[model samples]
Target: MADIADPRAVEVSRSATGALASLSLAMLLSSLSTSIANVALPTLSEAFSASFPAVQWVVLAYLLAITALIVSVGRLGDLVGRRLLLVAGLALFSAASLAAAVAPTLPLLIAARAAQGLGAAVMMALTIAFVGDTVAKERTGSAMGLLGTMSAIGTALGPSLGGVLIASFGWRSIFLVNAALGIAAMLAARRFLPPGEAGQDRGATRENARFDMLGTVLLALTLAAYALAMTLARGRFGGLNVALLGMAVLGAGLFLHAEGKIASPLVKPALFRDPVLAPSLAMNALVSTVMMATLVVGPFFLSRALGLSEALVGAVLSIGPVVSALCGVVAGRIVDRWGASAMVAAGLALMAVGCAALAVLPALCGVAGYAAAIVILTPGYQLFQAANNTAVTADVGKGQRGVVSGVLSLSRNLGLITGTAAMGAVFAFAVGTKDIAGAAPEAVAGGMRFTFAVAAGLVVAAVAIAAAGGLRKRRSA
Candidate 1:
């Protein structure tokens, strides 16, 4: 075990290995639940005799719930206690999975999914928060990297796993699988994770411990509005989208106002003022947006532009996540050895190179080029995630870890929602067609190049921000 050299850091309440396993399972379960149901959308539609849009809610409900509640749940964990809440969250996720599996109606399934997402929100937030408790500060990157790897494995394994499960035991098997995993995670967490009382902020008192529920509600509503604005429109922003965006803007104003007045705010707006955190959040959002673009663009490019079959497209597309899973642990070790700030810069620089390569190389060299670019880009992403998460969380006070982790996760989720609409729109516009599925191969190729060129620019901006933040830290020091 790494030495606990930092005065504030302590050995875990139980075995670190056991705690890590529980946390890893939590991360995997949340991520797996996100993507697993997507492959079953068609089956759900047929089973429920529902329209495609209606069945789509099975996926969207979970995402929407997780997006809306992630930050608030994190803050809640801080006020109440992360360990107990994490256990409860695991139980809720497990029960909800079973509910979803047994739901006879489409609406019931959606409700179960939303509940499952609520539990996932807790899991996603607290798992990261618990890292400081479970590992030495010196090894934060490795723990962060391990979580990232589990996340990548879950994401990469989801569709393929779901496909296999569905073929063997029908659509219900997917939810059932998560149910089993959630049970195991809960048991391990109950046995191994430290208690909620142990990790509370040093100076905190019950008098000041009241949760800012109003602020949480306001933020959740505002985020839900903004997320809906980005998601519901798909590639097109119509009247509903504009109205939701307006609501989001108005809600943000109200939330800011409410937070200023609340005795215990859900998030201290002042936290964003920290040099390391401010840029880290922005960088996370920007990098997440670029990463999401690869998912948005890859399938269309592989199938339409390169004329690959669906099976081949799936196989090729899996490469990115596979790279991410393989690289996450190694990247974390590098961060521990080298330092987060430098690794952050190196990772962003590598991502920039990868994105640029993707823009040009794929168009010129096809599958080999696409594969090569993904190999570079995915590791860079893992490196950035491990370093960025380590940097952001390490700088925060212990009491704030849950809330900060939530906010960081929130930024990434928002970026993903934004990328789904914005990047996809960019690709569509570049291709010069509203009907992307019907567009010619050449148009698709040109679109892929242009879209990733934009992504590369985003990464360059992130690199500049990271450099600036590092400079600011030195001057402040």
Candidate 2:
């Protein structure tokens, strides 16, 4: 390592701080865009005179685009340069937001949203990797924690902010706001960030520099087919759904086989073979699935089963996010001191307890009980995410940071899709009604309890896996 007292090191450290701020702001904006558009779905449906199912594509299309392209773009970042990719992503996101704000038809708006998702995938996949490249190794946990805090703040603010903007200035204002933020972030990044990685310029000259075009197409098709199949199977299962599912499996198999043989694979198989990396990724996916399932199912339970008004439901749900934000700051410090593995185990344990409370307490205490349970659950999620992210990134080498970040992002998207589909099916089966609105209050309550219990089981399994991995590590040591 270079001399610690060097003047250039000091200047670089100061610049890294500014770069971190820009990255954090971009993360917040990207997450805010995800949740903000959700509140406008009903308004858009009315304005476009579209059916509920059709208008739902506004959200689905964005998610699909992000999930499909994140890995491929991340690999590109490693080959070209993360700084260049990030700046381009910000510009694209800004342009897409402007396009969305002025769209004359629902289809145009949907297309713009998909474009926004593509930009978001680029920004998100590279942000953490950039931190790894720019910041000192010792301070990595603190920087990652701050990024997590910004994400929580965005998620917390989105719905309330969306509602206020829609009431005052209409739905277009949301996209307009995003456009402004994106432009500001882009300018800040260009001014503050250091030049691209040193070897990036030589990447084009390497004999193995060819991009994994086939692997990218196959992965995109695989995710799209699976997502569509799940959406189609929601209310009714039929031959088309079966065929789509088969197509998804075939696509996945081909992608994996192709990746294994490629000189420069989009996703290197060796990453999964690392003992530390493998378990961390698995826990990330499982924890995310449980977190998202609660988010989707909790509103249905509160609004339908308990007959709570929208305002009351929103207020109750807000408690968890607020707690999570506060906890995220503390969790980051803890990761630096106590280490990531311990925090992850402890956080998962808290989540399991909260899920158990939700499963059993609602019947006895009603709205107050559900609120109390979430109070436990949300902070746990925040802690686990911050710690787990730090752990997974720390284990990867600098050269492969981009691809590893992509894998983590992909795992999260898969978890979200899986949780929504799996929990929804269980809820429908428990209620004995295809239409949640038409189900009896008792049936809805039963469904909620069953879903929460299943979520608890998933968490317990994750906890067991974490414990086993810890044991194996100790024995090896």
Candidate 2 C-alpha lDDT tens digits along 1-477: 875788987788778888998999888988899889999999999989998888888888888888889888888888878889989999999999999999999999999999999999988898888878777777777777788888878888999999999999999999999999999999989988776672232323477866789999999999888878877657676898789889999998999899899787777777777777788778888888888767777888888989999898888888777777777777787778888889889889989999999998887899889988988888777778877888888857655777778888888778877777777888788888889987888999999889888999999989988898889899989
Cα misplacement distance, residue 414 of candidate 1 (Å):
0.7
* Reference-based lDDT, residue 4, model 1: 55
Model 2 lowest lDDT segment of ten: 196-205
**What is the C-alpha local distance difference test score of each model?**
0.91, 0.85
Q: List the residue pairs that clash in candidate 1.
A: none
**Against the hidden true structure, what lDDT does model 2 obtain?**
0.85
Instruction: Identify the leading candidate in terms of TM-score.
Output: 1
Q: Model 1 misses residue 149 by how many Å? A: 0.4
Stretches of model 2 off by over 4 angstroms after superposition? 1-13, 198-205
Question: Can you write out model 1's per-residue Cα lDDT over 164-184, one digit (the tens) per residue?
Answer: 999999999999999999999
Worst 10 residues of 1 by lDDT: 5-14
